[model samples]
Target chain A: MPKIVNHEERREQLAEAVWRIIRREGLEGVSVRSVAEEAGMSLGSLRHYFDSQSALLAFSMQLVAERIKKRIQSLPQDGDPRENIEALIGQIVPLDEDRLAESQIWIAFSTFALTEPELRPLSREIHDSLRDVFRNIFETLAQSQLLKPGLDTELEAKRFHALVDGLLVHGVIASEVVLAEEIAGIVARHLDSLLVP
Target chain B: MPKIVNHEERREQLAEAVWRIIRREGLEGVSVRSVAEEAGMSLGSLRHYFDSQSALLAFSMQLVAERIKKRIQSLPQDGDPRENIEALIGQIVPLDEDRLAESQIWIAFSTFALTEPELRPLSREIHDSLRDVFRNIFETLAQSQLLKPGLDTELEAKRFHALVDGLLVHGVIASEVVLAEEIAGIVARHLDSLLVP
Candidate 1:
């Protein structure tokens, strides 16, 4: 039998290699050559999958987004709304090793996207999707009568989004100061403040 | 007579060149040679001011921190506590062109610092200083009897710090979505929530 390769699996493996390099050396260190070397593949073979460095980076970032989306989708939604929401956010923030790595890759990609116009669309899409997540959380709270009456859900959604993102940034950059426990506590406190007293 | 050159002024000029390059081309475009060309100076002359690229980047980052600190210090201290706090935060977020530039440079440098060990201290110093800024805001509110009763100022400080930073990141990365007015409004609303109602 001839050798067979699963293209999607191979691409994911290459993306994981990109993530490892990003975590260890920052996005600036990411290039097609370096990624191919890290993935233990020849440069020509890597090119067959991703024609350019920009395409490779976009795929890596997209994979991060997809993983978070899949995790959130698989989460149990039948439990307490607050706990469910926390669980959803837990997958986004850097609470554990896997999440910590994801957050690092995210920040690295986000900062790089600021200057790379070709990468900006993926960054914007992720931003919009995250905003929807926050919006849906507020909607769920309002539908369940968990939100305080007369609160502007739109503005509150924006605030909640900003707060979570800020926590992610702080958690990644100054994990020593803003510990994981503190991040969870802050989220819980914010959630409590939203509910009827 | 020989022309006189102000050493400090010249260095600031070079730093400004670095800032322009960062804003235009991102940090990846920054190099001693590139910066020298951007500043209309010989590479040898630029090296006289900054012996290495690392030294140049450090000084540029330090200049940003100092500018922010100077701006904060110059703000009038005698004012309504809420407004004072708002004004203090105004200097930190991307509310204006100068601040937007500062924030871009900051995000770029902060992401770069993640894998650059030599730059970590400066990043940490800025993080600590920003934390102190938030801590003092809450303390000031408490002393003035403006804070809501029974609120945990320590945790609130961290939350407030994270929120403003989150706002800053959104403002820089998604200015069209977040908007300047939205950033200001979010800060005002957060302050209102902190006060006696």
Candidate 2:
């Protein structure tokens, strides 16, 4: 009998290989051949999954987004709105090793997408979706009567989005300076500032 | 008689070429030879200044930081603390074409620095300096008797730093969504939140 290969699983394995290369050598070091070599697979087999470097990079970037989304989706939503929102953000920032690797991959892809037109759509989609996530968080606070009266939810949403992204960058790049606890504190302080005192 | 070349001016020209290449093709396209070609100089001549690719990148990144520092230093200090702080931040975020280019170059270099150990010190230095700039802004507000009473200036400084850096990233990556005007507005709102109301 012929061996069975799970195509989806194989693609994910290749994407993980791309992540390892990105984490070790930066996005600039990522190429189809390098990724194939990293994955311990032949070029032909890797090409069967990702026909080109751009396709591989896009998939790798997409996987990072999906993992974060899945984690956020699986979080318990029965807690206080504040804690729920905090829990949601905790998954976004690089608070641990896995998240740190994800954050690094995201930043690398984001920088790459700036000049690679082919990758911009996915990058923009991720950016838009994250923006919506922030907006919904504010809406949830307002619905729960936790937000300050007369606050502009839209503007607050944008500010909060920027704050979290900035923390993400600082957490990944300047982890030594901005510790994990400090990132959480900053997020809590930001959330508190938007609520009724 | 032999023609004279201004070494400092020539180095700046080469750095500008690196910026143009980075803006156009991303940092992945930046090599000493590529920069030499972009600058319309021979590799032999380019090597007279930068001994290696790492040296070239480090200098280019340093130039970006220095340019921003110079702009901030030249801003008039005699205005209202709020406006002064806003103007100072204006020099940091990508509010215009020149700044937008600088931001893109900075982001590219920063992402490149992640896997380049030789480039980490300059990246860390720039990060530390920017954090200090935010700290000084809060101190200015406190000295001017404009800060909100009982606010933790340290935490507020970190929050403000994150917010502005976030705005910078958004202004560069999602210029279409965030817009220049929105970045300015976010900074103003953040500053307002820290001041006496």
Best by DockQ: 2
- Candidate 2 lands at a TM-score of 0.98
By lDDT, who's the top model here?
1
Q: Model 1 over residues A59-154: C-alpha lDDT tens digits?
A: 999999999999999999999998999999999989988988888888888888988999998898999999999999999899999998888898
What lDDT would each prediction earn against the true structure? Answer: 0.91, 0.90
Q: Can you write out model 2's per-residue Cα lDDT over A125-191, one digit (the tens) per residue?
A: 9999999999999888889899988888999999999999999999977978789999999998887
- Which pairs clash in model 1? none
Tens-place lDDT digits, model 1, residues B49-150: 998877888899999999999999999988877777788888999988899999998988988889988888889999998999899888888898988889
Please state the CAPRI-style docking class of candidate 2.
high
Q: Estimate each model's TM-score.
A: 0.98, 0.98
DockQ of 2: 0.89
Per-residue lDDT tens digits for candidate 2, residues B109-170, read 88888998998888989999999998898887888889988888899989998898888889
| Interface RMSD score of candidate 1 | 0.6
